[model samples]
Target: MRDFTVPAEAGLRDAGLGAGTTIALPSGRIAYAERGAGPPVVFVHGLLVNANLWRNVVPTVADAGFRCIAPDWPLGAHQVPMPAEADLTPYGVADLIAEFLDELDLTDVTVVANDTGGALTQILMANHPQRLGRVVLTPCDAFEAFFPEPYTPLPKLVRLPGASWLASRLLRLPVVRRRPWAFGWLAKHGIPGEILDSYLSPIHDSREIRRDARRFIAGVDKKYTLGAAESLTGFRKPVLLVRAADDRIFPAQLFERLSAILPDARLITVADCWSFVPEDQPGELARLIVDFATDRRADVVEEEHGC
Candidate 1:
């Protein structure tokens, strides 16, 4: 298995995410970082990103007396690839989350997710609600808009002959990734070079990684989310929906729609942020998570989710 440690230059430790660790799963070895020690809080990131997405938010929540576990799930940019024959579809990846929890013996966990991760969380809640305690979703793919608008073309791009390779090659240029239509829309501020490199290098260096990514892309569909929405309506567990005011990729109406669907959900809007709330509002995101987890009986919260 790969060492999977954060490089000294990346300075993840300084950002409060500490060193990396790995857990052996049937699919492959999963790399992760953990802090604090109490009822667990697991974080999930989206496509082309890793656990580093939560570098800032993890420690803040960890300091508040809860264990934080952030794993680099088998997205395109994960440092380690799943077994060659492993399934990389969205539902398959959702199963991986459930497997991770069962293997780690984590129970009644508060799952926090962003971007594509939120979509998976909805699936998990619908299909594997045994171990999860509650969930917090920051603007992500919902309903029949799995790929959203500007990004909807990605699935077809991955399916086109040699298109995945060409897309991977195009992504090699750092400048191209900084375009608004690219990863630039993910966060409101500039992403650090090292962090971005960590997210992009795996696919560049390994065909297997790219293969896994292509499979995930080909599996993207709104039906999975729509089905999850139906099951979610009956999900009585606590749910928190966080939306970024400045986000352009995911529609603002998603928060309201999701809140209305779930029997016990509250919506909060964070300003000056895009799709990635952890990057733009980690401090505020952390506070809301901790407060929600600690206060088990909060009267089915229906107030504004202000930071």
Candidate 2:
């Protein structure tokens, strides 16, 4: 095992590690962690959580005759210094991701996206169809401006002045912050100290990133997502939808809409998974990813994807 070290000047040079590769994005250097040796399988995380969220899944895919690269965006837990005025919309963020992907010269990439990332991946697949090989989306909150019910509306509220402070404080409460007990799934990615520190410490370490919570909320573009869905539903690539039976954030009702658009796409549901199914079922997810990536190319046909 090698060490992945992150530093300011070295910038994207290391992730306390000597393996993998990194590159400079518009905002700053992107520290990409890589391992194993084989075909490229890029793992991208959603907002709030960085590559660490994929820690459990990296090796699973890597060990299975595939190369894995996990890139840390400057916006999130990596705490990259944001420009005083950055357009952090879904398209804006996807542009940076596209830039990162281009720099890596990664063509035919099997892109795996979760949560907000799933939406971004959809955008990438639609806009940059030629660059994509296959896609895997899971527990994603795509397609709908109004977020699913029973979610911490605070994520959107975090943009307001007093709202973020309220969130930081509220998250500290055991009663209020207890992992959803409705199902035992969230327990896998619960707020344990190490998990909390790995995800939150970077943002907490830098007071500047307090603005990120604001940026994260403001970045949500329901329009862009809807358009991406429009494009992705007709995307000419193999797509696998990993549905968590107990996802609390993304309403399952929308799955019907998703299926209508992605008619040829296969669906895999984890009966006992919460919002963070990738963390809970990394191996299963990894296998599905490999299968999706290697499957035959599917052509797009125009139709009103049962929205």
Best by lDDT: 1
Residue pairs with clashing backbones, model 2: 3-16, 3-17, 4-15, 4-16, 4-17, 5-15, 5-16, 5-17
**How does each model score on lDDT?**
0.85, 0.64
Would you estimate the TM-scores of all the predictions? 0.91, 0.82
What tens-digit string does per-residue lDDT give for candidate 2 at 142-248?
77732344443635666667665555555444565464421223435564455555555555556566676467666565677788887865775677788888776
lDDT of 1: 0.85
Q: Which stretches of candidate 1 lie over 4 Å from their true place?
A: 1-15, 297-307
Clash pairs, candidate 1, are none
Deviation from native of the Cα of residue 105 in model 2, angstroms: 0.6
